[model samples]
Target: MLARLSTDNRTAFMSGVRDYSPMLMAILSWGLVTGIAMSKSVLTVPQALGMSVLVYAGSSQLAVLPLMAAKLPIWTVLLTASMINVRFAIFSAGLAPHFSYLPFRRRLLLGYFNGDVVYLLFQKKAFATGYVPGKEAYFWGMALSAWAAWQVSSIAGILLASVFPDDWGLALAGTLALVPLIVSAVVGRSVLAAVSVAGLVALVAIDLPYRLALPLAVLAAIGAGSVVDVIADRADLRRIRTARPAAGTADPTGRTGRTGRADLGKES
Candidate 1:
């Protein structure tokens, strides 16, 4: 019986993996670019791998590379990386509900693997509608694929960087990878609008000191999203009110009374 149960669990995990193929592909593409960038940069293979394993943030890695190559002060590198990564605070807030139930150790492990694409995909597909036991395994599967691909690509790029000193224009590879990831993340009008606004703001403010423009763009996106979230929350309350009958003794709409399923879904 124990062996049978183990097989069942494996099957379920495999199902989740199959469900995430497209997302995994997009992640792989992004990982490739990140690897290429790391290889081309000044860092040695071991150092680049260490950053990938420890920091695991594409934007932050990219932002700090130029400064590191220039032999800038440690404070300058620290500030630049910090500004680039401040957006993760908001990402973590948005994802807290889905992950709050996890054990502390597991949560820390998940944090190590999570990235923008992984968070966004899990939000739209798995957590937004409702939680599913074992569904989080799919996220790790996706992350694992991307992580392996990135390491290989980076190593290859580093090896080839010396030979192809002709500048393969490898930096542009990141842009190519980001397009599909952006497409997969689009959920509703509010998110789409936020992306457009943020892109424009970032382009215009690219010259700002200390790379403050990136954070400013992030703030603008957050402000726009918060406004939308507030309006959506009000509408949700109105829905609940109308769904309840005059007496309010029970769930007239069957939503409040039935396992609280309606409330189980995320605010999105």
Candidate 2:
């Protein structure tokens, strides 16, 4: 399938694969943990497999599993899942400018493949370059690699859940695997603020019913980040204004009034 792509696109695609390779272990660990959890839950093996294949969202699946096990109403489960996945809306918005020019079906497929790690990596690597050729190919490379790793590990976990002892602490391993990724993404003050706020909010609301804390943390983080961004923008605007010469007060030859008058006196 990749052979159909132009040489530049193929190169970009492979570069994406290489860049995303480092995260595959983390993805595998999380997928395995999620699959094991689903298997051990009230869901039957078929249901667990189905979810792993179809939903393809470990976080949303994990968030909604308990509700499902408790026989919650369908609407409640759907609502909780939607709220938990609300960040995807933001991710989609970030991605739209890059991929919106594609055919509708292609765009829909791309959305299905989008994930937290993929979005982050794409933003860091390709977003600044804007909507250029080979960007989509690069995205597909990372997306396909991640999807494959997840599905393979998840399926293995479902099949081998009984073989792996609970004492192995795989869940902790999975969580630890994500720490590096999170730390790497905290590159600026806004991201730092968002992360800190989200962590605090999640802890504070941990005991909320129906896993409400997750959505609360997400929203709080976005708000905090946005506030920080607005402040930074305003500060930048003020600095720019302060640096500019007052209108009609200075000569157009890059000279201030005092400097221009001094030059005039010297010329005289």
Candidate 3:
């Protein structure tokens, strides 16, 4: 399938794959833990496998499983899952600018394949370079690889849940593996603020019923990040405003220093 792509696109695609390779272990462990949890829950083997295939959201699945097991109303389960997955809305918004030119069905498929690591890597690598060509291919490279790894590990865990003992600490290993990824993503003050707020909120609300803490943390993080972004933007605007007149004064050409000869001619 990749053979049909242009050389540049194929290169971009492979770049994405190589960048994402480091996170494969983390993704696999998390998926395996999720699968084991689902298998041991109220869900039958078929139901577990179906959720792993269709939902493809480990966090939401883990959060909603207890509610489902408790025979909660369908709406409650749906609502809880929706809340936990609300961050995907933010992810989609971030991704829209890059993929907006694609067909609606294609965009929808891309959105479906989007995940935390893929979005993070895409933003760091592709998005940072602006909307250049071959970004779609790059995204697909990471997304497809992540999807395949997740499904395989999850299926394996479900089929062999009984073989793996609970004391193996696979869950802790998965969580630990993500720590570095999280730390690496904290590139700015806004992100740091968001992560701090999210962690604090999650810890505070850990005892909340129905795993409400997860959504609460996500919301808190978004709010914190938005506020920080606004502040930073305003600061930048102020700096620009303050510098504009000085720059104009220094140039005396009203061209914002583009013509370096203005000041030289004036001094002469």
Candidate 4:
């Protein structure tokens, strides 16, 4: 059996919360909008609260709301929700390496808590310097903090939804919240390529039926990024493969081979 709670774990958990503090503003904003949307929709207060708790999926929830209100087909709603969340699949794959050492159950729980902002922050820190000790602690810290902030803000939004006016332009506020995160995540050429493609695709496909634009955009971005990642990975492998033999040949004498070593010795 594993020790689930330890001093290190507690410390890391708190640290994760602290590291994730700045991004909480964006998260809370989005959650607030999502909660307000849910409360204003056809769903009852209890139903909205239940969805907020059980689904905890702002994008999918929002995506399907208009469809639900318009009495669209059930299949359409389900499909749209699944497609909208396709990006989460990509996020999960990229995140797998960081927590591969953990057990399945623990990893699943962590995945549940690890949403977009936490994933981005963790990815930046982890990929930049490689994994250091206490990374797990940091990961959990960020995850829990994001989770808590989202739940609280959304619940607040839901409760106070009626008091809030529709013309408040909260959607724009939520979009503004994402600006920092979006800028921060675009760190490399590959990421820039992905973002460009996703944006272009989304704009072009904005009127696609069944609300397919979002998922298509996500797929486009993932495809672009994956290609870049593959090319980079292969290049790294080739470089390593070349360096290993060259290092072996050079040996301690700083010569490429036996003849070079002999020449150096003769010169000495």
Candidate 5:
């Protein structure tokens, strides 16, 4: 039993690594930028290292740094970071069903490691195949690979910021890396609608202070996506309802009037 479990875990980890491998470059590029940004920020080395290790959120780290650099109020900085991480709340809810049988502590660990890409890949597979054994392995596989790559890249960037050239264009590299992911995610009508709405909202609200546009765009995208999904589901249900036979979908003899009747002459 133990051997079986061990093999399952190994396979799961490998699957996750294989699936997320293409994304390594993108994540590494982003992490490098984040690391450099933190190193160049007013934060001390220890402070930057602690935030990268402890916070583990590139966006949140970036969000509060400018505020810190400006000597802003503590409450404002906290709020800014909180808003940037609001998507995690949605992720937690979406992933709850997959790990509901596990203890709270285990679930918490999974939540801690879950990233946007992890959530996206897992969700796409889950919806397509429904529940399958060893899902936890897949989850950990993708999450851990991403976490490792991110930490390594960011730490290197932080440590090497002084030596790294500004002309290396890590930021642009990161953006370009995201193109494949963005295209992959835009697959179905509902997803396309959500992305379109979110992009539009972000562009329209780009002037908002404290990076408020991000959360606004997130909310708008959720609303748009939910609306699209609900409409699609209702349409599907309506089609099913219309196609189903009414009350007595049979002749008085208790045979189906349509398909059943056609077979009677041949049977006789």
Candidate 6:
């Protein structure tokens, strides 16, 4: 009995680890970047460490840190963080369908750990397949790995920042770390289009005061992509209607293509 319990525990832990490898890599890179940035910035080592553990949102953290460095007001810092993270509301909505089947406790836990990469991966797979097995386990796996790596690396960065030369460009490491996740989230044309638009807008608006331009760029990109998608959807429906045979129309091959005949053949 003891042996069986031990085996079960090992299997569960191993499963979590196996599923978490990719997330771990991302978190490590992100942590290193955040650590280096924090140490180099005006924030002290303790504050940086605290932010790494408490915030857990990379983009938001990066944004808030700069504001802090600039000696921005607390209200501005909080508002900027909120705006940058508003996308999570959409993420939450997307996960609602899947969460419907889970218990309240599990759903709450999933909400806490559901970042862009993990949520996108799970969303893409969930839509492709009817459902995912071990989704909760996978969520926990990624979350635990990300959380642990982020904390450790950020702390390491604080400790090592002074030792490493300023030329090391630790922030670049975090940016590079984000590439895999961004690439993975690239799904259909609409999503690609939105990303492209966002990039252009951000570049153009980089000089905006108080980072207002950043959020504006994001909104602009989303708007542009959404307009294109709506147009495409309408065009597609028009094409579909034109191609569809009219009611009571007969096929060219002397076969009745009515609902009855179509049902008999089971081809449609």
- For each candidate, C-alpha RMSD in Å? 9.5, 3.4, 4.2, 4.8, 3.9, 5.2
Candidate 3, residue 195: the lDDT equals 96
TM-score winner between candidates 2 and 3: 2
lDDT of 5 by residue, 108-184 (tens): 99988999888998887754333556788888889999999999999998999998888899988988988888788
lDDT of each: 0.69, 0.89, 0.89, 0.82, 0.87, 0.73
Error of 1 at 6 (Å): 4.2
For candidate 5, the TM-score is 0.87
lDDT of 5 at 172: 88
Off by over 4 Å in 6: 1-20, 101-108, 127-133, 248-268
Q: Pairs clashing in candidate 6? A: none
lDDT of 2 at 109: 90
Q: Is candidate 4 or 5 superior in lDDT?
A: 5
Tens-place lDDT per residue, model 3, 1-268, is 8889999999989988998999899899989999999999999999999999999999999888888889989999998888778889989999988877788999899989999999998888746434677888899899999999999999999999999998998878878888898899999999999999999999999998767898899889999999999999999999988876554344445555636765568879
TM-score of each: 0.74, 0.89, 0.87, 0.82, 0.87, 0.76
* Candidate 2: tens digits of C-alpha lDDT, residues 230-268: 999999999999998775477878788788888999999
**How many residue pairs clash (N, CA or C atoms closer than 3 angstroms) in each of the candidate models, in the order given?**
0, 0, 0, 1, 0, 0
Q: Candidate 1: where are CA atoms >4 Å away?
A: 1-9, 23-33, 126-131, 163-167, 171-174, 232-268
**Please, what are the lDDT tens digits per residue for candidate 6 over residues 1-268?**
2244445454544566565576666677677777877888898778887887777787788788878888989999999888788778778888887667778897777777777766765565454222455554555655576677777887887788777676776667657766877887777778888888888888888876656666777688789789889989999999999998888776676666685587667965
lDDT of 1 at 50: 82
Candidate 3: segments with Cα more than 4 A from true spot: 126-131, 237-268
Q: Mind sharing the TM-score for model 2?
A: 0.89
